[model samples]
Target chain A: MEKTYKVEGMTCGGCVQSVEKAINAVAPAATVKVDLENNHVTVTGIEDDNLVAQAVENAGFDYEGPVF
Target chain B: MEKTYKVEGMTCGGCVQSVEKAINAVAPAATVKVDLENNHVTVTGIEDDNLVAQAVENAGFDYEGPVF
Candidate 1:
């Protein structure tokens, strides 16, 4: 399954990388794509959205819930 | 004096607050303002740019030198 969520506070490439890493750290099997321009992160192969969201928050970014 | 710096890995209000606290921690008299749209942090009343830069990095963000 794939889910797209809004992530806030990312401004640079490093932030994008950090977000991706954070997502992966929580869901090792998931693939993460971060749209720096859109502030959205599309994650695939993850079953738990809350885990991914926690990963984002733990990494110091705002996990603005999920993008329906 | 005021200087605007480019900081990476900031996403959300918490990141902004963390950045501000990090800056003030190093330079107690300085003030910090974060522009989420611009990806810039404008700081005032700080004497050492290097110190400020270090502070940003210490806060776990990528400090891309300065906006000069």
Candidate 2:
């Protein structure tokens, strides 16, 4: 399953990488895409919202819940 | 006055610049310094938290309130 979440704390390309790494660490099989322009993170293969959210927070970004 | 806000969404130097520019746009005279290492923004010469926070949101980042 693929899910997109509204996240904060990313500013540039580096931040984009961080967000991807952070999410991938938790969901190794998931493909994480960081949209810096919209502050959105799309994770494919993750089913648990808490898991992804935790990873995002651990990476220092605030997870403002999922993007509907 | 100098105020440090706990900002999120910055991952690299480019993010640092974006954050600075976002804040500076709101307060033209403010010296906005972005600390990517700590995800903090030190803005000098601004007094209204609302203004700074608004600028951040307008710049496409999430404003998670002030880091007091």
Candidate 3:
């Protein structure tokens, strides 16, 4: 399943890398893309919302949970 | 001079705090505010741009220099 989440604190390319790393840490099979302008992160192959949320939080980002 | 900088990697309130602390560390008298909506940070009371940039970088953030 794919989920779109609202993440906060990302301000650049490095930030995008960090967010990707954080998400991949918990779900190695997941693919993440960040929309910096919109503060949205779309992930594929990750169904556990809590897992993704925890990863984002542990990386010091604001995870506003799954978009829908 | 009051300067506004394009900062990257700040995604949350904690990030804002981190940025503020980093700036204050180098210039204790300076004031820092993170504009998450626009990825901009406006600072006052610090005349040295290099000092502020260094502080932000050392804190693991991307400092894109002053806006104007």
Cα TM-score per model: 0.52, 0.52, 0.52
Interface RMSD of 2: 9.2
Weakest lDDT window of 10 consecutive positions for candidate 1 chain A: A17-26
Per-residue lDDT of model 3, residues B1-68, tens digit only: 67899988777666676677667877889988889989899999998889888777655578898887
**lDDT for every model?**
0.78, 0.74, 0.79
In model 2, what lDDT does residue A20 have?
A: 75
User: Which 10 consecutive positions of candidate 2 chain B have the poorest summed lDDT?
Assistant: B57-66
Candidate 1 residue lDDT tens string, A1-68: 88899988787766677677667766778999989888999999987889887777656578897788
Off by over 4 Å in 1: B1-68
| Candidate 1 docking quality: incorrect, acceptable, medium or high | incorrect
Q: How much is the lDDT of residue A20 in candidate 3?
A: 80
Candidate 3, residue B61: lDDT: 72
lDDT of 1 by residue, B1-68 (tens): 99999987777666676577667776789989999777899999987889877766655577886787
Whole-structure CA lDDT of model 3: 0.79
Q: After superposition, how far is residue A48 of candidate 1 from its true place, in Å?
A: 1.1
The predictions' CA RMSDs to the true structure, in order, are 7.1, 10.2, 8.2
Off by over 4 Å in 3: B1-68
TM-score of 2: 0.52
Candidate 2's docking class is incorrect
